[model samples]
Target: MSDVAVCSVVSHKFVPAQGMPVPGQVPASARAPRNDALRCTACSMRAICMPQGLTSDELKRMESLICPSRTIKQGETIYRANDSFQNIYAVRAGSFKTVVMHRDGGEQVTGFHLAGDSLGFDGVSSGHHSCDAVALEDSKVCIIPFHLLEAMCREVKAVQQHLHRMMGGEIVRESSQMMLLGTMSAEQRVATFLLNLSDRLRMRGYSPTEFHLRMTREEIGSYLGIKLETVSRMLSRFQRDGLVDIRGKDIRILDHEGLVRV
Candidate 1:
């Protein structure tokens, strides 16, 4: 069988599509059907993934360049460091964390990706991935081959502009993260992290005030450039101060303004 077909069969239970109810919202047996067909225009992530100002015909053309969406199970590596840069991926569902291995043989978590986020931009200059993209949960991603995408960008003005904007956004995000790690205190860093996650979740139609964390404390600390113990302590302090309610991995922001002040 074809690789795509095999992937579809293996991930039939969790194909990662829009409108799938989040965990705890409904029983698995009661969830709605998933759209297995890989059509860009029909995808719920169309707005986030597609180039701005594209017509339906243009979207169809863009879709034709993309390969079938592939599922990456939790803890699976999407791409390893130094892998050849052939394609960039769009998160169709779930989240992923990217890590860079240090010279000392330790690894540093560089960033976390959620649905609608783009991955593999780091390989643009070096022609190979600088970090590893690993799924934090069972996830799906639509693969956009780089060479075809580049050719299309030349023909489509909007597509080129969108690609530039995505690259610019990545630079800005990296700069902000460096500032956060270099300047912000531990509490401030954690506060910013929560607020950022909340904002991103809100954009995705999820409740900003309440949600479950996909990454563990160690992973979060690595991304934030802090110690795991410090993360735990700050979270406990936040709960004690009535800023949030934490139950295992679930978090509810009880006092958004209070958190903002921290």
Candidate 2:
């Protein structure tokens, strides 16, 4: 609701509220999870996207706080620029890319989000989204209605602190991107992208040395402020030098130290 999230001043007991749909919201093309219940403790992404200090009592309430997760197909827009900000979403499955289009029809890929990532923060300041979030694959997102979330934050100090930390992380990520685009060499940019993605996957309990790239070279180029040809060339060079093994979207980091030196 605000540029920076603040815990609500009014305190009330946390309650299990029903899902309140957005006006004219798009119907989910797929069904909700099996059994029609979500166990936050059992969720793979809880450690990444959820508050760490929630007691068992508090975590139970989160089942109702986050509405049934929605599954969107590849190429579907999660939220477009200018859409009203009603909820923030967490990726429960798959990945997404955020893009901004100029008046002249040119587009730039701003960021890539994988499972355990959050979306919709771009809308907080203006009450409307500033970019388009599109799934790179069939993806599912846990939607948290903003008003209810604000109320939860008011009564839960741990939840409030977690929200603030996430918001701060977003700012730091953007600033790092600025530095990447402004000063990094082409090789450094490409290397950093791979290393950064590797680190995230590792954090999410996936193999750090081997993973698939959900986004294409052109998409990576746009995000890195480089040409598509350069992206391809960099990958080719890395492979030739035995720094990495990349075939299509599948990549294996052959030499982490070698890549890092770039």
Candidate 3:
């Protein structure tokens, strides 16, 4: 299909829900009939994911320029390390984990992205993606052609500032992750991870204390610089201490104060 004809975003608004790992079951929302939407303005994630203070003219330009939303099922990759960087994406539904391969031939997860996140900036400097963006659930991402976005930013001060803020946020997040691996104990890492997830969920209008973990323990361990066993052990310990309840991937933070103390 022509890019212009498919430019309207497909309505794939994120709604937090999960269940047992069953292969045949994809999200009902993923299977829903595609409805052409008004690009950025119609997106439910706009408040958290898009630039602020866009004038009506700029917004219309954005809606006109955006490419079609792309669907990626669980375990599918939206982009991989070394692919030519042409566009960035905004999370419209579900979540993703970005990973890079180590020289030892293992995947080292760099980040877990959720609804309202913007991705693909890692390639801006090099013209190729440095990591693979693998969907953790059936997902959709609104593709923004980078060349067009750059042109818009050059003309719109608000848009430029928003891009700067996005870049700054990513820098802070990576710095925090480095500190997490170097300074924090296993227990503290686990607690801090849960707290951070809870905080992000709260920001996205989900319950702060309860949510399903989309990434598996092995993936979490990769991100935290811990082992799969250590990840399981930490969670078990937290459950025993009444800090959290974990049933497979489901996690409920029971004691926010106690967890912070850990």
Candidate 4:
């Protein structure tokens, strides 16, 4: 596998094309229904987004750089490998999985993105996406125009620093995944995966001990570099050992400490 690096600094300015809707305006077709309206300033996930720590005035400026949130239905492609890298998306709802295609026609599951996660940084260096991002469920994402965001980053130190940190996070995550695949036992890998998911969900205010699996056993196995059969067996073993309760996709951790010691 080629080593993945943090996205390069994109330095460009954006100009609206004639006949195009100005940035940040929600088209009627793209707008969520009244009860499910999307607004960055009012969003509960704002703290986890790029706009975190901005003043009210700065936030308004930040909002002007983003297009209205759009939805991706289940099984839909959010972006394909080699697609033009114009924008990075912030997940507003639901989840997605990113896969990298190989020369042999096989694909590797690279990462799973949940609400508040950013996508498209992998495209910055080559000016095209490095992998395919697909919706795991019906999802919504706020589009941040790359050029405009780059310009804003120049003037907003916090925004620039935050973006750097986000990029660094991607590198760290990939490194950890490599370690998991190279050294961990099947049971250890499975346990670590569950704990990681639990921590992420907890950060989003969901119950740490219980949640539904968004990906299938096969997907989990692929991400962990294990066989699908092994994935199933480990999960069953965990349940038998009273480490967790699994009824289909829903899982409740019965002993978080036991899982940590797997």
Candidate 5:
């Protein structure tokens, strides 16, 4: 098995679940199936994950079980570091970044979770989040009771499989970051990060190679473990080489192949 597979296996070993009712909280109106959801309802990610396996009837039943929440605004704290963990947060729309504070009071971004991504899962074991989750833009999310999900996993084979896959994907992404940090040069790291971001943007129905940077250069440097000046210099170099064009935060990839060449 590859290192990526190993990471997945390790992550799944700790199935984080906390604050779920023992028997599960069945909303009084949750008798019907959630199959007939014509629209995504509250979740933006329904197109990618939910509403696919469900029928109208199933959806109707599930709708009663679902509770929708308001969208989080940009720069708002979804949850602070060490906050009590109660629910599993699934990104219904927009984006968020998980961050940790350094001893000197600086912030280090741990991960960015975009639309359709999930956060707060790692907190299940400790009952408190180790990092802060903040919204990058106004975002919506579904809050599923953690214990309910865990209980459902016991009898629902499909839910179990879905959890497995999601956790596995998280492992792969985290491992890739570790590898990139350990082995890549500063330029390689920045290029690879852009490519990864572009791919994720494409997956979410956007222009992969052409988009405005939502996070600032300072934030990008924090994410990449580099200095702001270094990031600026790299972008200038890329522009000179015609690998990418940058005007303010707007970036256009002129030569994807050239950017990838190490």
Candidate 6:
């Protein structure tokens, strides 16, 4: 594969994560019903996130408070390393990945954010971003002017709690990544990544065990701290062992327990 093919490119055909309605198309009956469109947007993460505590009026106010920017093309940088932080960005659509470069010229993927995921939290403290955020596909983001969101959070208890919880979650995720890289064998790392992806997809309201890979095997290997050929070999082995099914970019976990035992 070409080096360019290994890099993630955000495409217009990208689907939004769960909790977002189909973009730009609304049923005629939806217009007359008492059903609020934002509720449809709030289908997931209702109990644990900032959107949950906001009243309809507050949400409307939030919509107006934040400025909507044009969709970012795949591979476009949202912000580069050392860029000044001006706004707290919320992913309104599509996905993003953060990359940090090492002094040795190696690249480490810090995290991947899907729709409704919050970015810019780290920048709040650093003032300048430590990593580069690039769109995985054509994506929309809402720029919540930092000053406005800061003031609102001071007044809203739920928003404060939500931010705290999100930060805590970040710590946990990083810790999990460390464990995966430090402890797991190549086969185990691949298995764990498969499980992790399945969990994340399920959280996004997709099939947990069966889905397409958004990131390339090279990217996967990079993130997991392994060689690309090792990733490919292990995957081939998994397929041969009847633990997984791989076709094109699509993957299906045929034996969950067997995968765990890898």
Segments in model 1 whose C-alpha atoms lie over 4 Å from true places: 1-36
Q: Pick the TM-score winner.
A: 2
Error of 2 at 194 (Å): 0.2
Q: In terms of TM-score, how similar is model 1 to the real structure? A: 0.85
> What would the TM-score be for candidate 4 when compared with the true structure?
0.86
The sequence of per-residue lDDT tens digits that candidate 3 reaches over residues 157-251 is: 98888889888988899889888989999889888899999988888898999898887788888788899899899999999999998888889
Q: Which candidate wins on lDDT?
A: 2
RMSD of candidates 1 onward, in order = 10.1, 8.8, 10.6, 7.2, 7.5, 7.9
Off by over 4 Å in 3: 1-35
- Candidate structures ordered by TM-score, highest first: 2, 4, 1, 3, 5, 6
Cα displacement (angstroms), candidate 3, residue 15, comes to 26
Please list all clashing residue pairs in model 4, or write none if there are none.
none
lDDT (C-alpha, whole model) for all candidates: 0.78, 0.78, 0.76, 0.77, 0.67, 0.68
lDDT of 5 by residue, 20-82 (tens): 222345543244433443335644466654534655654454454544444676777667777
Residue pairs with backbone overlap in model 2: none
Query: How would you encode candidate 2's per-residue C-alpha lDDT over 1-262 as one tens digit per residue?
Result: 0000011111121122244455344223112332454566678998999998788777766555677677766777778888788888899989888789878777788888988999999998899999888877778888887766777899989889988998998998899899899999999999999999988888899999999888878888888999999999999999999999987889999999999999
lDDT of 6 by residue, 1-262 (tens): 0000355423232223332223233323223422444443443533323455677766655555454334777787777777777666777667777778889877777777776677777677778888777787677775556666566678877666666777777778778888878888999988988887777667667698888776778777887889989989999999999999999678999999998787
Clash pairs (backbone) in predicted model 6: 10-74, 10-136, 10-137, 11-137
Worst-scoring 10-residue span by lDDT in model 6: 1-10
What lDDT tens digits, residue by residue, belong to model 4 across residues 84-172?
A: 77778899989888887779866678888889899999999998888888777778888777777888899998889989988888889
Candidate 2: residue 194 lDDT (0-100): 92
- lDDT (Cα, 0-100) at 180 in candidate 2: 91
Alpha carbon deviation, residue 134, candidate 4 (Å) = 0.3
